[model samples]
Target: MDAVERLRRLCIDDPVDDAADDPGWSDALDAHTVSLVRIGALIATDAPAASMRSVIDEAVTAGASLQEIVAVLEGLIGDVGLPRTVAAAPRIAAALGHGDDLVTDAEI
Candidate 1:
């Protein structure tokens, strides 16, 4: 299967039989850009801390500096609006290892 098809299956918890053979997401975009874009999507969706964690790790592994990641969040504010950005901030921060305290406080 193509890489995008494999990724679609993985997203829904389906197993890709030949996932090991897939070239992965870096075929088009570089790993670093893809990782940062994933982070932005997570932020835009107000995704949970657990979901953000892995993507953030991937971003870091792909050589995304903390500043660039933070810039992704900041840059989306105008597009996504303050409320969504605010709601997502703590989860993203927690995923980045800022502390669960931020998440807890955000919940309150």
Candidate 2:
């Protein structure tokens, strides 16, 4: 299955732990899926100023709505915790806007 589909399945069908324990889970949860989740978590946690701005920019690029981004972050935080969620946020944001300027003068 495609990455998006696999992620959807992972989110809907099985508990995160069940999928995490599966050998193929990592393969299914591709970079994009992970990024989406991370971006979502960052937004939900009221991340650092730089981090929140970065995630918002990335989510906009990734075609993810603010609400969608928030949902993903909430899910990640609910499953994991603040630290991991925070760590993952920037990466996910970066993934969405790989070379783009996620930060702006106004944001800084």
Best by lDDT: 1
> On a 0 to 1 TM-score scale, where does candidate 2 land against the true structure?
0.35
Off by over 4 Å in 2: 1-34, 40-47, 81-108
Residue 66 in model 2: shift from native, Å?
2.3
Per-residue lDDT of candidate 2, residues 1-108 (tens digit): 455756676789753455446544466565446557655555556556567566556556657664666567557776677776656555545545532475433333
- Candidate 1 C-alpha lDDT tens digits along 33-96: 9998999899888887788898999999999998998899899999999898877777777777
Looking at candidate 2, what is the lDDT of residue 37? Answer: 60
TM-score of structure candidate 1: 0.69
Q: Which candidate is the best by TM-score?
A: 1
TM-score of every prediction relative to native: 0.69, 0.35
Per-model CA lDDT versus the true structure: 0.81, 0.57
Cα-based RMSD of candidate 2: 10.0
